[model samples]
Structure formats: structure tokens, C-alpha cells
Target: MTDTYDVVVNGASVAGCAAAVLYARRGAKVALLERRSDINAHKVLCTHYIQPCGYPVLAELGLIGELEEAGAVRNSAQYWTRWGWIRPEDRVGPGVLPHGYNVRREVLDPMLRRLAASTKGVDLLLGHTVNELLTDDGRVVGVAGTAGGERFEVRATLVVGADGKDSAIAKLAGTPSETSPNNRFSYFAHFRGLPRPEGHSAKAYYLEPDNAYVMPNDDDITVISVLPSMERLGEFKADLEGAYRRFVKALPDAPDIDAAERVTKITGTVNYPLVVRESTGPGYALVGDAALTSDPLAAVGCAWAMQSAHWLADTTAPAVLGHGDLGAALNNYRKRRAENLKAHAHLIADYATARPFNHIERFTFSAAARDSRMAEHFHVFGSRLMSVPDFLSPWAVARCSMVNGRALLRPRAQPVHSGERVLTGQGAR
Candidate 1:
């Protein structure tokens, strides 16, 4: 027997589940397919900080409270460059939305899938993997695949490729994608009893050609991630624990190793590149890493997944509900995703090269550290609330340039702090 739905979403992970839920809530019948037969299947390797942009969707899904109840950490970011710790603002106070959530994907993913499964108009298809696109006259009409080792077909008006970076839907449908080479190796593991960095829920250390993160997560466990230059891969592969610990422990003011206990095996990825896929194709749309994959330094992956799903669903839901043109809706989805993520993705790609910060980057970082307004703008930009271009305006650049230029002219005034902790979140100390 064949089943049909308004939308058949591939990969019932974060992005796919979000798309399925949104579509179902809009009264469109949706089928969510997941290849994982285990009900508790979840992602193991992720930075796990959902950016501020994801809050609205979590609220819409009514899962924010559930997340909090599950011990999700409220997060803010403090950055450490050669200049100093570019601190967050004085207040981590509540805003239109809570700051953000820091929870492991192991906890977050299943919760998201449950929401999709329980939604009224959504059918959850577990243990299903798409093998071929069922097309008609050049338009994708549905998909045929195996579910629980049995062959089956499902027809849908629109297909969504929310599969991870390597999307089967994109491959089968011939979705055009551009790939940017990433020159870093990343590994992360959980630890308990580590002292918190401060009021900020997460902190990043930026060493030229390498970076590391300390993320406070649920159950009092902290996740420490390190990304080193590709040339250093052998060192990591040789003694991963030694390399990972050496990379993170050497950072200034890091956690007390004497007190913390390594709670999990070191896990990581080496070859995930920056991929920008054509977001919309004939009779279909893509979201999450499938549509656009960014550098993980900014920790935007998780939230981008949820946000892209929201964008696709909001833009295409009208058409799926018979109130708008499908082509126009798909176009809107493509445009919106590009409009929001293009500038951000460009900056990430640049940073992904694992090179030292140039002069302009130093100026920007120092100015943001020295000034509250720039710091606020940086916060919004890093939170994915503002675009990179918007965050670095020409006027703001001129002001920063002047300040940095003056400092350069005077020997006593160094615009960038070399080793001092210039920012402490409250103010420069």
C-alpha cells in the first residue's frame, strides 16, 4: 500500500523534525522519515549551543519549557583572541527570548523528534531510507524507499531534504552544491567537575591557526571542543587525548584539570567542509546542513538547522496549503535563507581557513572589546540576530579605524591587548 502526504521530509533529525512539525501545525499532512530504527538515536558530535534565533521556534513548538526542565543551560559567549577576552555585555538578563540553550544533541534531538511524531498531521516513518526520487514529467512527485527492510513508496506534493551534510535527497535529486575546503580537525568530549569560566555559559579561545571552546551543558557536564589546523592532524591522530587536552589545557584561565573528570571518549570529525547547496529545486526544498553548512567555530550549526527549517516551512507552508504558488514559495525560501546566512557564511568560511587574524580583524576585535556598542553588535552578530555586514557597518568601521590608527601612532597605546584579560564581561579590567 502507498501513502501520500503534502510533504515528505527526509531525516527526522533536528531540521527534518522541525519542518515536519511546522508543516503539520499548518494543517498539511506530513510524513517524517528516519533511517534510525532506535527511538533514542541522536547526534554525538555537535557544539550543541542553539543560537538566539532558535528561541522563537522553540516557543512556537512549546518545547522551551521542556528543555529548561531537562536542565538545558542558558548560554552567552565570551571570546578570547590575542587582543583579549571580548566580553559579553553587563547583563545576561532576559530579553524577548531567553539567551539560548546549551544541551547535548543526545538530549535535544530525541525531544525534537517526539514533538514531530506527536503533532496531529504528521506521520513518523521510522527505519526508512530513501533510495530513489519518484519523479513525474521532470518534477519530483514523491520518493520510493525501504522501511524496516520492506519496499514502499510515498507520494508527496513537496520533498524536503533535511538530511545532514551528505543528503541523499540532494544527491538523488541532483541538487547543485558548492563546497569550500575546511582546513581544520575538531574533537570534543564531555567532562564533569570543571569550574565554570564565569557568568558566561560558554567561552572560546582563539589561537592563530587553531581554536577551542568550553561549553557548559546539561547535568553539570561541560563539553570541550578544539579545532586545530589540518597540518596538526597527525599529532591529534597520534595521541588524540593528549592532543585534545594539550590544545585546550594550554588556553589561559581554562578549567582546573585537577578537579574535572573526563566522562566520555574523545570524538570528532576531520573532513566536514563548508557546503552551500541550492536550497530549492523542482518540487522540493532543503534545510539545515543539507542546504548550507557553516564553520563550527561560531557554533551556528544547531540553531541554523532549526532556523532554516522555520524559514522553509513558513515560506512553503502557504503554497502547500493551496494559498500560494509553489514556485514563488520555493523562491522565497531560497532568498530568505541566502539573505540571512550569506554574509554570516562568508565570514565563517574565511575564518574556517584556520589562519591568523589579519589587521582588520584585530581592529574589529579590539574595538568590540573596548566599546560597549560594538560589543553589543558583536553579540547580536554572533547570536545570528544580525548579519555580518550589518554588524560591521562602514561608519562603525571608520570609528574603529580611527581609534586603532591613533593607538598605532602612539607607542604607549596598543589598540590590541597582547596578553591581558582586557574584557571581563562587566567591563575592561
Candidate 2:
């Protein structure tokens, strides 16, 4: 059978669904195809935290209030460094706005799919797998797919490839991709009755080289994740639950994650390489993990995915409405994404390869922990509020360096008294 659509989107996950909804809302007839038979398909391996920058997009979609109404808990970021716990600075008011939502993917994915399916002008086709791109004169015109033993062809002016990191459309379009040796694996599971730290919404304990993140989501549940390099994958995989418990217990001022009741079985994935690729072609574009993926250590994937979807929608809406060339539109989309995220990619890449707490990281972390102002800057940088360079600029670094120098230069002296330890300043002889 043959069908027609203004835009045919492959992969009905968050990115695909968002694309379809945005295009449909702009009055374009969109056909959204999903290989999964279930509309509520869940990504088992995600941390499922969205940054504050993404709230604007959700609000624009009219879903932020709905999400809050649905019990999504707001969260701030806390880093458990060797120096101490680096909470958001007082100057920043709270870390919650920058780091944002703690929601489950199981809840989020289904809600987005339902929104896309219900949007006007969207035709959702579940359980259909695209086999090949339909091209005409070197330009992608549509797609050919198989659904339930029946072959179908969809002809559209524009095709969107939101099919994720291993996007078939990106491969078919000959878009070159760069896959780096992330070599890191993560194991995570949900737990109930985990005692969340007071005034700290989420905690990331960086135990040098490897780290564990504890994110408190709705319904008294917290997600605990540990990311270790491939060399340690076997150790973790051999006994996932035990390894997770050991890591959490080892943290300074450790939370009660070990004591928390397990609400789900422990899950793990190894050697999950980070991928970044060109996301546009003659008549198509990619979004979400389909466009680029970074180390999940930063917990920025979901936000980036949704933001990229919004960018694609905004960029292509005019072209789809006949105001510009579709190819040009897609190229513009690629340019925007690269401009916005390339620096972040470089930073993450460096972190993945660099040995932990080298001279530079130690200097930075120590400085930030001592001064709330510097901590605020660090928090903003980590939360994606400011660019990497901006956070690491000479001025910012100088301010931090000064504080660190003072902390280092304090006089060495005897203890204040027996059984009493001075945390920062030196005492008299």
C-alpha cells in the first residue's frame, strides 16, 4: 500500500515523537513510524534526568505544568568531591533551576508518545520498520517499510530520522559518524525508601576516574547509577547489585542507598561508546541520540534530545510550509546543533579520556568548594547553563585560583586541642 505525508518520521521515541508533534502542530501531515509494537517503549539504560535548560522547551510545548501535575520532582545537583560536598552557592539561590527534573524514562517516554499521537495531523504507525530510503534524483523523497507482513511506501517532501544513535537513515544517507572509545559501562536501578540527603536533591559522588550518581525521582524512588571504564566492567557485571552497594557505601557521608528497598532489578550496559554524527541530508534530518550522543555522566542526554527536536521543528517549520529549500533548511539545522553543542562534546570527550583529579581538576574542584561564588560558576557550567570556556575563562579561573592560593598558604601549626580537628584554618603553636 502507498500513503502520502508532508513529513515521514522514523523512530517514534522522544525525539521522533517531538518532531512529529511540532510538525503536525504547524499543520504539516506527519506520519510517525515506530519499530516497537508497544507505544510506551522504555529505554532501560538512561538516567532519565533533564536539565533546567530543557524546561523552556517543555513549557513551550505546554507539558511542563502537566509534568509537574503528574508528580515530577524538581532537583538540584550536589557533587560529592574528595574535598567535600559542593552544593549550589547561596548567590545562585538554588541549584534546582539549573539541574532540574528528576523523572523516570518509563513515565516520560509514554507521555511524549501519547502527546505526539494525539496531536492534530499526526498519523502514528506502530510496529513498522523502515527497510530503505525512497530517493528520487539523488534526493530522499520518502521511505519504504514493512509492517505486519505488509509492505508500505510513504512519499513525503521531508523525512526525519529520529531513530537514535544507530540511525538507519543516517547510515543510508551516508552521513559519516565518529565513535570514540567511551569504554565505560553503567549499572543502575530504581529503589524505594532511599533516604535523600537534606537540602540536596541529587548527588554525584566522583570517586576519581569512576563515579556514582544518585538521583531522587518521584514516588520516594531514587535511581543509583555507577559508571566505570571497560576495564572494570567485568568486576561490576559479575555482581551488579553488590558492586553498586559497595560504591555507594564508600562515598563520604554516604546516603542510605544500600538501605533503600530495591524497586527494580539491577541493570547494566558495558562499553557504551559516545557517538556524534552529521544529522542532515538532502531531504531529511536527525534529532536526539540520532544526531549526537555524549557520555551519560553529565546527565544531559534527555535535555539535548528534546532541545534538538525543538531546534529541528523551528528550523524546518518554515521550509515545510514552503518558505525555503528543504535541503538548505536541514543544513542550517546541522550548523545550529554543532555550534551549540560542539564545545560540550569536546569537554565530555576530554573527561572520558583524562585520568581523574589531575593537577587541573584538583585545582578547580578545590577552589570551587572553598568559595560559594566559584561553586556557583562550577554548578552552572556542569548544568549546561554556561559554555565550558565561559566557566573556565581566565577571569573565572583567576578568581578561583586566588581563593585556592589563600587556602594553601595558611600557616602550618599544632592542633587546636586534643580530640578536636580544625577543618580549614591552622591553629597556634
Question: Which candidate number maximizes lDDT?
Answer: 1
TM-scores of all candidate predictions against the true structure: 0.92, 0.93
- Give one digit per residue, the lDDT tens place, for model 1 in 113-180: 88888899999988998999999999998988998778989999999999999899999999998999
Q: For all the candidates, what are their Cα RMSDs to the real structure?
A: 4.3, 2.4
Candidate 2 residues 1-429, lDDT tens each?
Answer: 789898999988778888898888888999999999998887877887888767777876678777877778787877878878777745556543464688898888888889988899999999999989999999899999899988999999898999988898898888888888775678888889977665447888777788888888877788888887667767776877677788767777676765678889888777677888878878888899888878888788888888898899888888887888877888888888887889988778777762577787788888877888787777778877788678889988898879988987976655565456554334433
Whole-model Cα lDDT per candidate? Answer: 0.85, 0.82
> Lowest summed-lDDT stretch of 10 residues in model 2?
420-429
TM-score of 1: 0.92
- For model 2, the superposed segments whose C-alpha errors exceed 4 Å read 89-96, 358-360, 412-429
TM match of model 2 to true structure? 0.93
